[model samples]
Target: MASNGVEKVGVLIVGSGPTGLGAATRLNQLGHPNWLLVDKEADAGGLACTDVTPEGFLFDMGGHVIFSHYQYFDDLLDTAVGQGDAAWNTLERVSYVWLKDRWVAYPFQNNISALDKEDQIKCLAGVVDAKVANAVAQGKPKNFDEWIMRVMGPGIADLFMRPYNFKVWAVPTTMMQCDWLGERVATVDVDRAIANVINNKEDAGWGPNAVFRFPLEGGTGGIWKKVAKLLPPERQRYGCQLAGLDKDKQVATFADGRQVAYDALISTIPLDITLRWLGQSEWADGLQHSSSHIIGFGIRGRCPHGLKCWLYFPEDNCPFYRVTVFSHYAKKNCPADGTKLPTLCKADGSGPDSSEAAEGPYWSLMFEVSESNYKPVAQQPTKLGGSAVAAQGTWPAVVAETLAGALATQLMQPGDEVVSVYHRRLEHGYPTPSLGRDGVLKQALPWLRKHNIWSRGRFGSYKYEVANQDHSLMLGVECVDNILFGTQELTLEHPNIVNPRKNLEMKYTREPVMPGLLASAKPMSAQEN
Candidate 1:
């Protein structure tokens, strides 16, 4: 502990992501001013951060689309970016699946026309069987696999859901639970699927996020970077990593050797990391997570494919689950017109066998792959000393595999020139809905609360249902409401309850938005006995 004699804050937040910022914003709105927020990164926006290549192409960590279920979330974003069309580019989602060597309209389950006659027959048979079983069954599915089999049947499951989900989750469908599937997974309409296959018709306009907006200037990271600016600067800390926490002392130690004590600590760090910080070895030992490798490639010329977004690789030719036409989000994401650049290498890291500079207009794509103990990523060689082109290794065999898969799926031509590349491995990417996750959280949350610590966020609470940007922001806002007043944090305890339009009336407007007038204004620490 520092020699400041127990300096206290009403609340201390451990992350600057949407959730943490939401809490801070709500506390500020309520006028309970004694609080502080910290993040490990140099700026705000956790997974939402955007990266820029040397060639001037911009890509988000992953493709993130904006769709809000909460008015408060909408209000906060609008306030951050200003309520104008100039800050955003709204486009209808043009997404598809590269299956059977062709483009199939999205919600792969509904686009059987894209598959061959045999695959179509298998899928319809399974769908019919699942419908019959569901109509007769009176109990719930035992696991995610069973739920998928019961709803989509073995044929569709074998074709799309099983393989695609395994690629995304880095775990077999049997290992996951079924409860998190609400609204996230699209259920196949048996009649429509069969009709489309019969008539060789492509199904269109399916699922959520049919249309979404992207930030025009700063990329996805710009949104949160802007939101962080709205908060009182004195209360926010960036680039300070939490080294440890003393629950009994109500203190959090930073990597820089500074210590801060608080009446309550709201942590948005990964729960396992939080446990290790608190020295709860036993609890931390039980938590597990899958890592993710995000790869971005900048290429010259207009997009070879007309599709805006699509899912690829059901045959395991590569490691990625999805690839996005990142350049489609914004032209500024690439170089300005007439600028020339050469193809450095092939997607597999192979070259033209000559040291040459290529030239001009460029486009980019982003891909995400999951990794874990069950699905280990192969290693790849690296050139010494940061050379743009060097001898390659196979540790990231997935990289080469992905390159091959992209070509096999027709995402890129065999000779497509790769101008710029970006790759990063995130330790905790998607929160897995494992069999023991909910139980671990159930025990861990109350245990932490006994020490005045509130762990919440995508990995904070480990709930995937409410883990998107809108839900995440609301989680923080609601947590503040609970801490400052006695308001319920609906997004935290009940995800489905808060999923659809909870408080649209509170959305941001030109007038300064504040929480409810009756919301408590007294600082929690000041009032604590």
Candidate 2:
């Protein structure tokens, strides 16, 4: 420890994602100016970053649409972009599922018309059986699989829900508990589902994000980037990696060899990473995560598929669970109209050798592939012992896999010129809600708190319910509020509690409140929720 003199602050925030930014903003709002924020990245927006290909095509990590259930979140977004239609595009989420060679209106369990006649009958029969069984059963489902079967029956579960969920979560449904299924899963009504199947009526607009707003520029990351600018520059630090922590000393050390002592630390970094930094290895081992590979493809010409968004690959033509038409969110996401670019290569790295430049408007699609020990990626090696290789036997292998899966399910055509490609692997992409999650958090969080540290965020707290952009931000905001004032840290302690309403008063005209100091040299309001 080369004594740089003790630089103490009221609060020190790690990981400047939405959560960290939220905390800083809230601390500023609460009139607490003695706080510092830092992130490892050059900018904010953790998993919400936008990637730009060499060809000038942009793609978000996956499908990120803004649909807030809290007024506080809404107010922050309005403040970030200013209250106007010009800053955003309010689009009804036109979504679908690709099943049995047809486009089925999403919440696929409700639309059996897309399946074969045999599948349809099997699904209906299962639905009826499930209804009958449910009418006589008592108590709640013990696991997610059981709850899914109870709600959707065997037919729909077998055909869609089970496989699709496994693909998304990269874990078996039986391994997860049912308690986390609030508004996340789409539960289909048996009677309505059967009726719709019988009448062949489509159930299109369903679920939380039936309609959402997208920022006009910079994608989702742009929102938080703008939000970061709203704060006083001196108090924030970006592009700084957190190295370790001296828990007893209440000091956080960064990779640059700088150490900062704090009265209280609000860490939004991954819980496991934080544990490792604090040398708490036992608790770190308990947490689990599924890595995600975000793949983006920019193609020449207008979008061939009429549909705005769709979820595909239940049958394993590809490793991806969902693919978003990223260009649909904003035209500026791709190069301007009439800009010419040459095809890098095909999805399989094979095609006609063309150095000739192509012209006109472009569109892009983003695909998400979940990876874990259970479901590994199948790509080809680019070279010996190199990470740049695509997996072998993956979806890119089959010739018509892309277009057929596209047209047979309706996303694109046979001759859509692919202009650009992008692929990035996020090691801790999603916090897996395994059986051991709750127990680990219970022990780990309190232990850290005893040392004056609060670990929170998507993977930090390891609660998926409050892992979205808005929820993560509120987690930070609430943590600061709890630290500065006696306000409840709703998102951190209770996710469901905060999801239904705004946690704070949203008065735009008035100045925000500030934090007050306390005795014992601790920041006031240090009680944990």
Return the top candidate by TM-score. Answer: 1
Q: What tens digits encode model 1's per-residue C-alpha lDDT throughout 1-529?
A: 2367555787999999888988788777766758999998999998888878777778887778887766566667887887667888887888887776677778788888888889988999999999999999888988899999999999989988889888888889898999887677788898888888878887776655677788887788889999888888998999899898999989988898878899999999999888877777677776767888888778867897664764555657656888999888877888886776655676545674555555567888888888998888864754311235553322355566666667767777766777776777888998889877788888899999899898989889889988988888877877776765666677778766555332222322222344332244332110111
* Window of ten residues with lowest summed lDDT in model 1: 520-529
RMSD of each: 4.9, 5.3
Model 2 TM-score on a 0 to 1 scale: 0.89
lDDT of each: 0.77, 0.74
What would the TM-scores of all predictions be? 0.91, 0.89
lDDT (Cα) of model 2: 0.74
lDDT of 2 by residue, 219-315 (tens): 8888888888878889889889888889988888889988899999999878998888768788888888888878777888778667566566675
Error of 2 at 102 (Å): 1.2
lDDT measured at residue 482 in model 1 versus the true structure, 0 to 100 = 73
